[model samples]
Target chain A: MIEVREDWCKGCNLCIERCPIDALEESDVLNRRGIRPPRLKKENECNYCRLCELICPDLAITVISDDPDEEEKKPVKKTLLTPVGGKIK
Target chain B: MVEIKTADELNKKFLREGMWPTIFCNGCGHGVVLEYTFWALEELGLDMDKVIFASGIGCSSRLPGYINADGLHTTHGRAIAFATGIKAADPDFHIIVFTGDGDCAGIGGNHFIHAARRNIDMTVIMINNFIYGMTGGQLAPTAPLGSVATTAPYGNIEHPFDICDLACALGANYVARWGVSHPYQPIKSIKEGLQKKGFSLLEFLAPCPTAYGRRNKLGDIKKHWAWYDDNTILIEDYEKIMTYGSEEEKEQVKDKIQLGVFQDIQKPGFFESYEKLVDRLKEKEAKTKEGKK
Candidate 1:
C-alpha cells in the first residue's frame, strides 16, 4: 500500500513524471497548500518498485509492503535525545 | 538487523523534532537527496552517534540542522575546514558535509581543493543548484554557461566549474555526479562514499525551481526537473559514443553533462600517513633510549 502525507506534499509532481508505468496522477483535490498532490491512479499497474517514494522531493510518499511474510519487520519508533536528558533508548 | 524501512519510518528515525515540514520550496531536490542519504545510512547500519553533519551558509547547507545528529553550522565557505578540525580531533567520527555550489565551489574553493588533495576522510555531498538559491539567485560557480540569474540579467558569460572533474583530478578516493532524477545510483554512490576511507565527492545537480528556474524561465517545476534528464548523459554511454559513435551522435552529446563515477582509487588518507610517521618516530626514540641504557 502506498500512502502519501498530503500536508507535507508540496505538489512537485516529480513522482508522477518519474514513475515508470505512469501509475500516479495529479489529484484534482487541493491540499492545504493549494497544490494538487499526486495519487496512485493505477494500482494494478503499480509495481511497488518504490521509485516514487525515492524521488519525491518533499519526502511525502511511503510504500508499505503488503506481503504477509514481511509482517514481522515492524520497526520501533525512536525518540530524539534531548540536550540535557542524555541518551534515550 | 536493520529492517527494510519506508520513507516515513526513515524520517521518524532520523529527522529531528520541530524540523518537520522543511523550509525547502515546492519541488526542491534537497529533501530527495536527504532521503537518499538516510537510506544509505540505514543500509550501512551506521550509528548516528558517531556521525557528524557539517555545513556552511546556503540552502543545501541548512540540511544538517534537520538531521537528528551532531552537526556544525559553520561560517560561510568554511564547512570543510571545520569538518577537518573535527576529523583531526577524533578520527573515529564519520563526517559528512552538505554544502551548496556557492558555499563549496565559490567561497570554499580553496578549502575544497586542499581537502581533496590531502584525501581527508570525509564525504562531501555537494548540491549544485546552478544559482545561489538562498541569496536571491546570484550566479553560482556551478551555474551553466549563459544561464540567467538575478545577477546575470541577460545571460551568464562565465564558464561553469565541473566539481566532480576537479575532485577526480585531485585524485580524490571517490567521485561521482548524479542528478536528483536518478535515485538508485545516488543511494549506491552515497553508500560507497560513506564506506570509503578517504575523501569522497558526490556532486548532485538539483533543480531550484523558485530561484534558478523562475529567473531562467524554467518556472514550471516538472519541466525544470525534466531538463536534468535531458541535459545529462551517463559517463559510460558518453565514452562509447566518443569512441565509435557517428559524428551526429557525438555532436548531440557535446553540450551534455557527463554523469558517473569519474574516479575511484585506493590511497592512504592524510591522517593514516601522519599516524605512520608518528609511529616511526616513536620507534626511533625507543631505540635511542635502549642504546643509551
Candidate 2:
C-alpha cells in the first residue's frame, strides 16, 4: 500500500493522469481547508507502476505493492513498507 | 554541491530585485547567456561600481535584472539606446547590453542599425534563439527560412538576417557569431569586446526548448544541440571549404567565411571624436570671450 502525504500535495493531478491501472480515484474529501486528496479506491487491483511519482510536481504520492506485478519491468527500488521485515521489511 | 544559483540568489549591485525573470524553462538557452555574461565580467575584473547592464524586452533581456550590478532594463529594442546613454553619461563605465532577436532586430531595428553605423562604444550580446522564445515563440527577423515558428505554422519563407554580415557592413568595428554549443568562443569574444574600444557585437545562437524546440520537432535540449552540430559549419580550419575567394587563398580556403575575428579595424569611436569636437568648441568659446574682453 502507498501513503499520500496530503499536507504536501497541491493537487496537481500529475499522478492521477499518469496512473495506468486506474486504481487511484480522487476522493471528494478535501484536506487542510479544502483540496481533494487522490484516494486509493481500487488498491486491490494495483500494479505498482511508479509513473505517478516521476510526474508529481509536489512529490506527494507513491505506489507500492508486495506481489510486484511489474517484475519484468525495471527493478524499481521504492522504499515501501512490508510486513515485519518480510519482503521489504 | 554549491547548488546552482538562481537569479534571485545573485545579489550583485547591477541586478535589481523583483526584476529577475521567471520566463525561461528549465535548462533553457537564456541560462547560457547569463553564465557567459558573468564569465565575461569576471574576466574584465573592472570596478563593479563603474559597470552598467542595459537590456531590452525578451527572455535574454531579463538577464540584466538577475546579476548583482547596476542595470537598466529598458523598453523593447531600446537596449542599445539605453546603453548608449549610460556610456555617454559615464565614458569610464563598462556598458553591456544583453538582448534577443525580437528585442534587438524587431522593435529596436532603427536603434540597432544606427548605433552600429555611429560605431557606438558598447558591447552587445544578441542571443538569437531563431524565433522569439518569449511572447509565445513568434517568428523573428533572424528565423531561418523554412524554420517553423508559432506564427509560421507551415514554414518561414522570409529570409533571415545574418547579424555578423549586417553589423560588419553597418560600420561596426567588431562582429562575431558563436552559438551556445560553442559557449567558450562567445565567452572569449565577450571578454575581448569589452576590452576593445569601439562598438562590438556578439551574436549567440541559443536553443529555445519550450517554443522553437517543441514546434520544430526538436523535442529536447539535447536534440537542439545535435541540430547545431549537423546544420552549422564552423568557419575555422580554412581548408574545409570547396571554393576559396581567390586563386591563392582559394587553394588555402577553397570557399568559406572564416569564423574567428571577422573584422577588427581601427574605426574612430563616436565618444573619442565627440570629445575632441567638444574640446574644440570650448577652445573657440574661450578665444572669442578673451577677444571681446
Candidate 3:
C-alpha cells in the first residue's frame, strides 16, 4: 500500500519524475499548501520499489507491503562494517 | 536481513513529530538530506541517545533542531569547534555536524581544515547550495563560477572550492559528494561516514531552487532537479573519459563535477593517538616515582 500524506507534500514533483514505471501522477486537486501532490495513478504498474519514498524531499510518500505478516516482522539490526571506499556497483 | 519499515515509521521514530512540514521552501533539498540521514541511522541501528548533533548558523543548521536527538545549535562557523570539544570530553559519543556551505566552508573554514587535519572522529554532512540560502541568497564560497547572486549581480567571478577535494587533501578518513536527487548513494555515503573511525566529510550538492535557481534562471523545480544529473559525472566515468577518450569527449566532462568517494583510508583517529600518549606519559610517571622511592 502507498500513502501520500497531502499535508506534508510541498509539490516538488520529484516523486513523479523519479517513479520508474510512471505509477504516480500529478493530482488535479490542490493540497493545503495549494500544491498538486502526486497521487498513485497506476497502482498495478507500481513495483513497490520505494524509490519515490526515498527520493521525496518532503517525506510525504510512504510504501508499505500489503502482507500483514511482513508488517509484523521486527526491524532487523545489522552490524556495522569497516569503512570502505568506492561507488556502489 | 534488511529492515522493511516504511518511511512513516522512520519519520515517527527519528523526526520531531511537531516539526512536520518543515519551514523549508518548495523543492528544498535539506529535507531530502535529512531523510537520508534517517535512513543511514536506521540501517546502522545506532543508539540515538549516544549520538549528539552539532550545527552552525545557516539554513542547513536548522536540521539538528528538527531531529529528535540531542544537539547544539551553536553560533555561526563554530559547529566543528564545538563538536571537537564534545569529542574530547566523551570520545564514545557519535558526533554528527550538520552545516551549510557558508557556515562550514566560508565562515568556519579554519575549523574545518584543522578538524580534518587532526582526523577527528566525526561525520560532517555539508549541504552545499552554492548560495547562502537563508541569508537572502548571498554568494557562498562554494558558488560556482559565473553564478548570479545578490552580492554578484553581474556574475560570480570567483572559482568555487571543491569541498571533497579539500577534505581528501586534508587527510579526512572518508570523503564523498553527491547531489540530493540521487537517493541511494548519499544514504550509503552517510552510513560509511558514520562507521568511519576518523573525520568524514559528506558534501551534498543540494538544490536551492528558491535562492540559487531563481537568480540563475533554473527556478523551475523540475528543471532544477534534472540539472544535477546532467551537470555531474561519476568519478569512474570522469577518469575513463580523461584517460582514454577523444579531445571532444574530454572537453565535454571538463566542466562537469565529479561525484563519488574522494578518499577512504584507515588511519588512527586523533583520540586513538591521544589515548596512547596518555598511557605512555602515565607509565613514565610511574617509573619516575619508583626510581625516586
Candidate 4:
C-alpha cells in the first residue's frame, strides 16, 4: 500500500521529479479538497520499489513492505530481499 | 575519557542477529554508524519497544533495518518530518532519524529547517560521507568543494554545509558532530540527543569507504578510521584548533566541529505546541456546533 499525506505535501514534485520508474505521475486534475495537490496516478503499478519513498521531501509516503505483509510485520525475521535492499532471500 | 570497550564484546552482547545490515558495502560508514548506534542504545539501556528508527534515503537510510524497532523508512529527505509525527503521537518513544547529507540538506532541506524550528522531540543522525553514496555517488550539498564524485569527476565547485552550524542556526535544541572513528563521542552525543527533550541533530562526518574510497585513496574502512584519528577534534579543544595558519594544517581544528554535545537548551517541544493546536480546534468545533443549535 502506498500511503501519502497529501496535505503535508508541498507539491515540490521532488517525489514526482525524482521517481526513477515513472510510476508516479502528476494528477491531471486537482484534488477535490485542495489547490494544486499532487496525486499518485498508478497506485497498482507501484513496484513497492521504495523509489517514491526515497524521493518524497515531506516524508509523506509509507510503502508497505513486501514478503512481510502488514500481518507478518511483528518483529520477526520471517525472510529477506524480495523488495528492500537485503539479499538474504 | 570514557572507557572504550572491545568491539567483539560489544557486538556479541549488544547487537541482535539481524543488526549487521547487508545494505551497506563492506567498508561503508553506515555499518560503522550502526555499530556505534547499537552500542549507544545498549549502554543507555533504551527500551526497544519505546525506540523507533526513522530515515530518509541514501546509504545511511539503511539504518532502520539494522536496529530492531518500530522502524519508518520515510521518503527521501523527510526522515525528520516523519519522525515528528511519530514523536508527536507518543512523546515517550525515542525517535531517531538517520539520513545522508544529500537527503537531509539537499532534497529534504525545508523539512529539516521546519522540524528544527518546531523543536520536535527527535534525533537526526546525519552521516556526512562527503559524497552521496547512494544513487551512484553524486556530489551532495555537504560535499566538500573540490571533492571528486560521480557528478564532479573533475572536482566539485560546491562548498559543503558545515552541518553543526546549520543545525545551530536553525534553532535546534541540540547540535553536535563527530567523526565515525572518534571512538566514543558519536555514542555519547547520541545518548545526549536521545535524552534531550527537543530537536537534536547529531551530524557525523562518517568516512564513506565506497563513495570516497576510489577517489581519495582511502581504500578501506580501517584506513578511513585511521584518518579520522588524525582529523577529529573534540569540542572541548575548539579554541585551540583555530590557530592553524594554512589549509595544510593538521586536523588540529577538529575541536571546532567534533564529538560532544554542542547545545542542550531546554525549550518547548513540538508535542507541547501541537496539543495546544489540537485543543483549539476541538474547542472551535464545539463552539460552532453550539452556535448552530
Q: Top TM-score: which candidate number?
A: 3
- lDDT by residue (tens digit), candidate 1, B214-265: 8888759978876777778888888998999888888887788888888989
List the pairs of residues colliding in candidate 4. B233-B254
Q: Model 1 shows how many backbone clashes?
A: 0
Error of 2 at B247 (Å): 16
Candidate DockQ values, in order, are: 0.25, 0.02, 0.32, 0.01
lDDT of each: 0.87, 0.69, 0.88, 0.67
Per prediction, the TM-score for chain B is 0.98, 0.85, 0.98, 0.82
For candidate 2, give fnat to 2 decimals.
0.00
Give each model a TM-score.
0.92, 0.68, 0.93, 0.65
Q: What value does the lDDT take at residue B88 in candidate 3?
A: 98
lDDT of 1 by residue, A1-89 (tens): 68898988888787887776667888889989899888878554556768789988778899876775654534323321111111111
Q: After superposition, how far is residue B68 of candidate 3 from its true place, in Å?
A: 0.6
Worst 10 residues of 1 chain B by lDDT: B1-10
| Model 4 regions lying over 4 Å from their true place | A1-89, B1-21, B241-259, B276-293
Error of 1 at B162 (Å): 1.0
Question: Candidate 2 residues A1-89, lDDT tens each?
Answer: 56676765555453554455655677788989377767677534455555454334333455545554554344433433111111100
Candidate 2 shows a clash count of 12
Model 1, chain B: what is the TM-score?
Answer: 0.98
Q: Best DockQ goes to which candidate?
A: 3
Compared with the true structure, what per-residue lDDT tens digits does model 2 show for residues B1-293?
A: 13322222222323443543334664365655666666566656666778788999888987866667788988889999989988888899888889999988888988999999998899988888888887888999888778898789999999887778888888788887765544466668888888888899888777777788788887555556545544454564443334434566445333222345567776989999999999999999999999999
